[model samples]
Each structure stands twice: as structure tokens, then as C-alpha cells.
Target: MKKRLSAAISSVGLILGTSLFSPAGAQEIDLYVDTVTKQVYTEPGKNRVKMGTFQQVQKGANRQDKKSSDRQAQKKTDQPAQKDSVQQARKDSSQQAQNEPGPAFVHEPLPERPKEEHWYDRMHIRGYTQFRNSTTVSGDKDAVVYWPDRSVGEDTSFLIRRARLILYGDITDNLYLYFQPDFASTPSGSTTGNFGQLRDAYADISFDDKKEFRVRLGQSKIPFSFENMQSSQNRLALDRADGINTCCRDERDIGAFFYWVPAEIRERFRELVANNLKGSGDYGVFAFGVYNGQGANRVELNNDMHMVARVTYPYQFSNGQIFEAGVEALHGRFVTSNGPVNGITPVMVAPAKGFVDERVAVHAVLYPQPFGLQAEWNWGRGPQLNGVQRLITESPLTGGYVQATYKYDSGPWGILFPFVKWQYYEGGQKFERNAPKNLVNDWELGVEWQVTKAIELTAVYHMMNRTDVLNAPYERFRADAVRFQVQWNY
Candidate 1:
């Protein structure tokens, strides 16, 4: 009986432990045992006696809770370091992304840049204006003299010598364009003044990227004289020497010209003009061209085209001084118009066709690096009025000038250029009405002050002896004058 009781109690403990002790939240339980019936009960009732409280000890659950707490504490302790490690990993990833190309799946497209402006938008509009005044300080004021700037003659008041507007641009890698118009032109025989006239209309087509080889086309200055090639705005003297100026009036004609220069030399030419050195810009180291024999603004009178060629070079010495020398020649026929006899009625004095108009010239220049010298001479045959026969004939002509100049930099005040020139010319002024014969011996002393980049002032004193181009009776006279000019650039 004792053995059976012990076995039954062991069986009950095993069953209860298996069912209750392993519950999720189970701990202890209270039970009442019926002593009369020998049965187990959870509550007290009839014939039930208090057995004892039983504790369901869950060893695995206690162990699991302790382990969970320990794990939580460990997590709290390591959280900062783990966070820093994660941040480091992200930083490295970002750095690597920058150094290498993005993955194909990333599908990131770079931003596009804006398009450049058009060539026309890049064109430049620039120009300069000159206002001049002249008075006969001495000599015969009534004498007739041909001054390139007509405003320099006696009885002339303040006038606009040149009012120009220049438009220029590089249209492409191999093409350039330049156009200029003057608003101060006076029409022949027209009383109205300030007529607008085209000065330069040309295009430079380059055969290479460097523009070392190029062709210029349209109405442009003829590569005849160095002084003629130099822009009037940049010339130190008020007027060009009659010797060279008489060859091509206005120094321009409609032509197609080919020019050649080394690329390095071309850059030096640009620097010369950019540095305010009195450079003729770049006609070329060598040039050849053909043009209508008629002068600028004149209608071509014949089928023949005039041929011209020039060769020039600028040499730089070890001391940084630049000197240039050139020779040029042109062959062509020139026709002249008749003027009124004694300022009354016009008549045909020139031949029905034209006269042999040709010339050869040589020039030298020592650029004004504090001190400078320039000279040019030309010999040609053109239609000239015979004073004795009272008829026009092709006559031999020769003329030239020598000039010296000094450049003084005045610091903030400005720059000063003092110059003196002497000229003599015996030629036919073909462009004049009668193609008058002229005898010229002149002296000019001038000083130019560059007040600023945009403004300049010049004063010149002149002593002149020349034939009167307007007087049909072949009058020769002498005159002295003082001229002043103010120029503005933009």
C-alpha cells in the first residue's frame, strides 16, 4: 500500500509539472486534497482539507529572462560604437562613389551646359570722331592749296574732319569682316555737307586656322604706301605727305588682295597696335592684289584692272626696337574729269580714254620708341595740266617726306608726341577737277596729347608753298597755318 501511494504521488507531480509548470507565465499554484476520497482539488469544499501550496519552478524561463536582460544591457553598451561604425561605412561608400563611375543601374544624368552666343552677337561696333579748326597764321590766305583735310585751308571754319563708325567681327574660325562708314564726307560740287560714305567694306577669308594666309575682298585700302595704310586716327601727322597721298586719293579702291605672314609675326603685328605703337596694322609681310583703276567712290571707267604688289617686314632688334621697310608698285590707267574754266563752265580736258597712271614707292619706319623716324618717296607719271599749252598731258612726277618724332609718357597726365616733318612734291593732283600740276614744299611741327584712352588733342603749325589746284590760270602761292584737332574714340 505504501509503495502504491508513493508511486501515485510521483505520477501526480509529473503530470502537474508537465501541464502547468511549462505554461508561458505560470509560477505557483494552490490546491486542496480530499483526505476521505484521496482526490486532488483546486478549491476547498465538502470533505476537502488543505494540502499545501505548490511552486512551479520554471528553470528554463528564469534562465531565458536573465539572458534577455544581459543581452539588452550589452546592446545599450555597444550602441554608440555601432552607430559610429555605420556612419564610417556610409562615409567610405560616398567617397568611393565620387572616385569611380556610378553603377549602370544608377541612371544619373549629368546637367547640360548652356549654348554659346552667336557670331553676330559677338560683333563689335567701334569708331572715332575728329573735329578740327584751322586758320592762316601767316602768308597769302587767298592762295589756293590742296589740303587732304579740306578743313585746313583758309576761310574754313570748324569742321568735322572724320566721323567714322566701324563694325567688325570674326564670323567663323576662318573668316572675318570689317565695315566702316564716314559721316563727314563732302560730295564733289555739292554744297550740302556731312554726307555719309563707305570707307571700308571687306572680308578676310583665311586659308588656315592661324590666319597666316588670307585673302581680303571688297572695297579696301590699297597696299601702296605705308603712311596710306596707317589709319588717319593713328597717324601722328595731321595730313599725309602729298608725295604718297597723290598716288591714290583716299588710299582705297575695290580690290581682291592676298596676304601672307608667319603666324608668330602676325601676333607681333597685333601687339604693336595693341600697345599704342604707331603701327600700320597688318597689311601683310607680302601682299598682291588687283583693283579697279578708278579711285574710291569713283565708277570704274575701263575694263582693265590695276595690278599691285608690296613686300614689307618689321624687324625687332635685341634692344626691343622695331623697324620696318617696304617697297610697293602699282600699274594702272587713270581717267580725269574736267573742271569749270575759271570757275565758270566745265570742259573735256582729258582724253576720251585715260592716261598712264603708275608709280613705285619705298618707305622706312623706325617706330617711336621714345625716338622715331619715317620717310617715303614715290615716282610716277600721271595726267598733268601743261601751264603753257593750257592742255593736260601725262607728266613725270616725284615727291616724298621725312619726319621725326619723340614720344613722352607723362604718367597719369597722359602721353605726348612731338613731331616735325618736311615734304616736297611735284606731281599732278589727278583727283582734282583739272588734274592740276602741283609744286609743294612744306614744313609741319605738331604735338599730340593723349589725354585718355578716349580723348586726344593735337596742335600743328605749318609752313606751305604749293600751286593752287582750283585756279585754272596755274597760280602758285605760299601759306602758313595753325591747326587744332580734338578726337574722341569709342
Candidate 2:
């Protein structure tokens, strides 16, 4: 009987434990044991039904409650450890950021860079102007002595000799460009009336590290005469001698020229150029070129091209004086007007063959150190019309000029230079209409006072004896003049 009782109690405890610990549901039944009937019962939806008998239903319920309490305490202990681990992870992240090299927070992106400018945008500009006045001092009213191109017709006149604007700059590391225009150019069919004309438009292509060797293309000054190559704004004399002027009218042409100078002497070349002596940039000891023989502003008359070359060396003494020597040559064709085949018959003929013109020249200069000297001579052959018959015939001619000058650098008065020149020329000017024969003896004395860096004043006296082969009635004439000029440069 005791065994039966114990079995029933144990069964009831198991059923109760399963009902309380198992997952609960909405329609679950509540199992119960009736001690009076010693039987189990179930209460489902408020109806109690007998299930089984049990002696310790209360003890089983108490044991279940103890287990639930222990489970809740364990959950509470594990939650704090989970929270500490999460906090430690956050702290580790902060420490890592502090140990880093750069900023803790990323910076806003940098603004995009501005666009770069083109090479042409960096161009440089410079220019100068000469205002001149001249009067015949001891000559006929019609006697145009110096600068026949700018003669004083009424014994005195004011003239804008030269007004120029220069534009130059580097196009690239190995390329450079230069351009100049003259507003004072004479009116001609090739140009607009005195508005302006292109003087120099050229590009320099450098091959060496220091640009000691270069090739120049376009219309630029030919490398023939030192005086011819020298900038008119820098010349000490009022005008270039007829001897050298006849070599190259305007001293510029459409051509390609090669220039070379040693790197060691480049600084010296720059110095001379800066001082406005006869230095041709860094155009070294050797220069040569080929051009249209008709000269600047003139179209080529014949198919033949003119060839020019020069060889020069500039030496500097310990005393800071400079001496330069050079030789130059040019070979070209000169076109002339055609004449009647039968002189008295009044029958016309084809134009005479183009004159084969050629010349060779030598020049030397001693840069002024308070006192200096310069000299140049040239000889050439070209078609010359006879004084009376006016027929083209080849003739040999020679001419040159000698100049002496003294420079004084006065403190407030600026640089003062007094100079004297003697020039003589007997030549055939092929570029002229009839190829006139020119016999000229001229003397000039001048003083240049630089009032400031941008201003200059000059006064000059001249004496001359000239023979014009083209003018029939007045082939020979003697003339003299006094001239004054003011120049502004920037």
C-alpha cells in the first residue's frame, strides 16, 4: 500500500513540474490532486476533472519557484558583464583614434586649383619715340644734306623720326617670339598711310642649353653691318653713313638666319646689348642668312635670293673697355628699269638683265671709356647709269666712315657724349630707280645728353659735299645743316 502511495505522489509531482516549467499556451489545462479522493484532477476552462492523486503538490510548486528565482539572478549578473564588454570596445576605439598620426576627424576636401595662364599672356612690351627738328645752316634751300629720306625742305622742319612699339616673349622653353611696329613709316602702296607697319616679326628656335645657338626665321635685321644692325635708338650719330646704308636699305628683310655664340661670352654679349653698343644679342661670333634681295617692304623682282654673312669677335680689356672687330659680305641681284633699244629711233626693248650686285665689308669698334673710336669700310660692284647717257653699266665702288667720341657720366646731368664723324662714299645705289652713282663726303659733330633714363636730347652740326648721278641738272651739290632731337624711351 505504501509503495502505491509513494508512486502516486511522485507521478503527481512530475505532472505538476511539467505543467509549470513547460511552455504555456492559451488553452493549457491546470492539473490538480484531490487529497480526500486520493486522485488527480484537471481544471480546464474553469471545469475541474480528476487526473491523479499526490501527497506533495505544494513541495513541487515551491521547488519550481526557487529555480525561477535563481534563473532571474543569473540573468541579472550576466547583463552587467555584457555592458562592461561593450564599454571596453568603445574605449578601445577612442584610444586607437588618439594614437593615430593625422587628425581625429577628416577635413573637408581641398578646393580645386586655378587654371594656369598661357605663355602669350606673359608677353612684355616696350617702345621709344624720336621728335626731331633740323635747319640748313650753310647750304641752299633745296640742299638736303643728312637723312635725305627726312630732309628739311624749308630750311627747318619738325619730324617724327621713329615711333616704335616692341612686343616680345618666350613662347616655350625652346622657342621665343619678337615683334615691332613703326608708326612713323612713310606711306607707300605696301602699307597704310603712316598708321603703322611691321618692322620685326620673327621667332627664335634655340638648340643649346644656354641658347648659344639659334635659328631665326621671318623678317628681321640682316647680319651684315654693325652700324646697320645697331638699333637707331641707340646710335650716337644722327644718321647712319651712306656707305653702310646702301648695303641694306632699312637693314631688314624676309629671311632665315642662324646665330651662334659661345656660352662663356654670353654675359659679355648681353652687356654690350644692354649698353646699346652694336651687340646683336647673343648672336655669337658667327651669323649668316639668306633673304629676298629687293630689301624690306619690297617684293622680290627676280627669282634670285640674297645671301649675307658676318664674322665678329668682341674682346673686353681689364680696364672695362670693349673692342669688337667683324667682317661681312652680301651677294644679290638688283632690278632696274628697261630702256629703249634704239636710242633715237624711239623703239622700246625688254628690261635690262638684273644687276649682279655684291659687296664685302670690314668693321671695328672701340667702346667709349670717356674716349673711343669706330671705323668701317666696304667695296662693291653693281650697275651704274652713265652721268649723261643714262645707260646701265657695271662699276666698282668703295666707301666707309670713321667716328670718335667721348662719354661723360655726369651725376645729375645724366650721360653726356660728344662725337665727331667723317664719312665718304662712292657707290652705285642699285635699289634706286636708275641705279644712281653716289659720291658723298660728309662731316658731323654731335652731343647726346641723356636727361633721364627715359629721356634724351641731341644737338648735331653737319657739313657735306655730294654728287647725285640720277639728278641730271644738279648732279653735284654741297650742303650743311644743324639738327636737334628729343627721344623718349620706355
Candidate 3:
């Protein structure tokens, strides 16, 4: 019995050892055990004990691996159904999300507001005053020689030609305003002089961001003549040409004007003024407007408005010299007032309806980049007194002036401009009380010294032969006069 049991145990040990050491692909092994001795064997026939075939345990593997394998196999069989279930769950979740409403409120940033500008910062103040004195050094002391600056002519009395205050500002990006008042104006026939008068009250509205197109409204300078449009403060000549000056009494009238200029050209115009080249400001490359026919500060007598138009351009050379040329024309009906002439004798009665007032002028300017020349001429028919008939009738008139000047920069000593001008006009003095027929032949030589930015001095000698339109028997008066003016700018 011991030999048999030993043999069975040895056989079982051999089978177990083979199963543990064999490769994973090896076949299962069969075994038997003796019931009484509990001895195992690989063959069933020897001990008459039977054991079923079993899984081969690989080397270093645990007994629980079979249970794990059974679970893995069951998971593989159920994979398709599980995958479908997961897909259906995702689809259901997406549909539920779409059916539900979103959150009640969402947070967002607010837009910022623009800062407002202060009134004081939106406006600017600037002005100039001219103190002047003039005497007829070699002519009749009582002879009245009408001057462009009517304040100083024959009297040696010291006077103020202009005491102006200007307020200008850009109210917004597209709107600009300009206002000026002259405190030194002397009203005709008034005993007291130096009364304040409106000079300019206008607004410029830009139509584009570049400000190339604009419209000016209210009382402003008429675009009738180049010299007429030039500001007296910037002019080198003490007086404007009588030919052009006669066309517009105060060089201004209530009107609306349109101006168009390229942005680049506008800068050049500003540079000319900033450099003291006597620029006319930005009058535009082309300008047209309608204004009251009765001149500045005067009531319109007729329903018809004065139509005026002008075209001008400044050309710059490679050497930085600028030249300009332009033409302007105006047509209107003017009613001469039968009122007392400067508180003097009333002349012939004017037409009840009005007289045809029309003119066409041409002007040229060479900005003094050292040396300059300016000239203007006009021809037209206007109301003038027929001395023999003593009636105000339309008469042909023509006149103009030519001026030459030189600009000198003296560094710290400031600057100087010496000019010579000769002017002739055979026309009607429409602004005068009688609308008298007048002839003006004048020669002037002057030097303007800009001692400083705030101070300026001008001295001019004039030889004038002009008709005395004030007195009843209008006679031509000749005089040699000298005038001096000092200007203060701020």
C-alpha cells in the first residue's frame, strides 16, 4: 500500500510540475487520486480514482484568473449593446439641453460716454488795434481826401483806425465760428467818434472730415476782389486800390458762401499767412455767393440780391515761391439814398426803383518770397451823377492798381516790407451820398516794420489827385500826404 501511494504521489507531482512549467498554449492534463490515501495520479486506471480534466495553471499565475477570464468573455459579448446604450444616452442629453431655456441673465460690459468740453476751452480770443495819424503836408488843409481808412485823412489829429476784438472757435469737429467787433469806427455825421461796429459775424460749416468743402453763413467779406478780401491787418499797403475798394464799401455784406479747396492747398494758404507773406487766408479755390447789394451795415433797398462769383488758385514752384491769379464778377441793382451826403448838401435825386450795378474784375498776386507783385483791374457800369443833367444814371467805369513789394527778415530785429503802389480809378463813388462821378490817381511808397509780433509800424508817403466827392461843386483835389500808423496785436 505504501509503494502504491508513493508511486501515485510521484505521478501527481510530475503532472503538477509539467503544468506549472509548460508554455501557455499547452493542453490540459488529466489526473486521479486514491480515495483512502488521498494520493493523486495523472492516469485514472491505476488507483481506480477519477478526477476531471482541469485548467493548466501557468507559471506564476493565480487561481482567480479563470474567474477573471469568464468576466472578460461576458464583457466582450455585451460590447455592441453597451455601445448603443451610450450613444442613445448622449443623443438624449443633447435633445434635453435644446428643449430647456438658457440662464435668465448674462453679464456684459457697458459702453463708455464721451467727455464734454468746457466753454472756456472751446473759444479763443484774439485781436489788433491800429493807431494812426495823417496830414496833407503839401496840399489844402481843408481838402477832404477820402481814405480807405476813413478815420485819418486831412486832420493832423491822432486817431484810432481800428480797435478790433475777434472771438473764434471750433464748436465741434465740423462747425467753426468767428466774431469780430471794431470799437474805433466813426459813424458818418456823428459828433462823437469811436463807436463800436460789427466787423464779422460768421460761421463755417465743413462738409467733409478733411474740410475740403465748406459753407460760410452770415456777415462776411464778399468774394468780389482779391484785394477786397484781403484783411486790412495783413495788408502791406495802407489802403486798398480804390478801383476794387469802391466795389464793396466795407468789404463785407450779409451772405452765404460756398468754398471748395483741396486739403493740401489749404495748408499752403495758411503757411503763407503764418510766414507773413500777406496771404488772403483760405478763400477757397472756387467761391460763389449772394449778398445784400447795399454794402455792409446798410439796409437792403431792393428785393434783388447781388450775385458774386470768384475762381482763384495758388501755384507753388519748385523753389517754394507762390503765385496766384483770379477773376471775380458781380451783378446787382442798387438804390442810392437821397439822404443828406455826410450831413452835407443833398445831391440829385436817385432812381426810385434802382440802377444797374455790375462789374467784372481780374487779379494776380506773386507772394513776396523776397519780392512780390500784385495787380487788379475791373470794368463795369454803375450809378453815377451826370453833372450837366444832375441825374444819377448808369455810366461805364474802369480802374485798377499795381503794387510791388520786397520782404526782408532781419532776424532779431523783426521783419520789414517796403512797397510801392500806383492806382487809378475813373468811376462813381457809389457809397458816397451823391453817388458822385470821381477820378482817383494816386502813388504811394511805404515801409512796414514788424518790430515784434505784438507791435508794428508803417510809414507811407502819398501823392494823390482825387475828386472831392463830399463838396457840392465836385472838384479834383491834389495833395502830397504822409501817414504813420502803429499797430498792436494780441
lDDT on C-alpha atoms for all candidate structures: 0.81, 0.72, 0.80
**Candidate 1 to native Cα RMSD, angstroms:** 20.2
lDDT of 2 by residue, 1-490 (tens): 4544554465455444444433222123344433333333333211224553322233366675766666466655644653453344334433432343343233457999998989878689999999888877666657453335364446456788889999999888789999999998875324233568888999999996788889999999989877887788888887888888887768889999998888768788788868745354665589988988777878777887888889999898888889999999999777755343224211111134377778999999898866889999999887676656446677788999999988788899798889999999997766665566788898899999989979999998887788654343326677777788899999
- Candidate order, lDDT descending: 1, 3, 2
Per-residue CA lDDT of candidate 3, range 61-145, in tens? 4644655566466655544544453344334433433443344443455888788777558999999999988877787557765
TM-score winner between candidates 1 and 3: 1
- Model 2, stretches more than 4 Å misplaced? 1-115, 145-151, 188-193, 276-280, 338-353, 468-474
lDDT winner: 1
User: After superposing candidate 1, which stretches have Cα over 4 Å from the reference?
Assistant: 1-116, 340-352
Per-model TM values vs. the true structure: 0.76, 0.73, 0.74
* Stretch of 10 with least lDDT, candidate 2: 341-350
- Candidate 3: 10-residue stretch with minimal lDDT: 89-98
**Clashes per prediction?**
0, 9, 0
lDDT for position 451 in model 1: 99
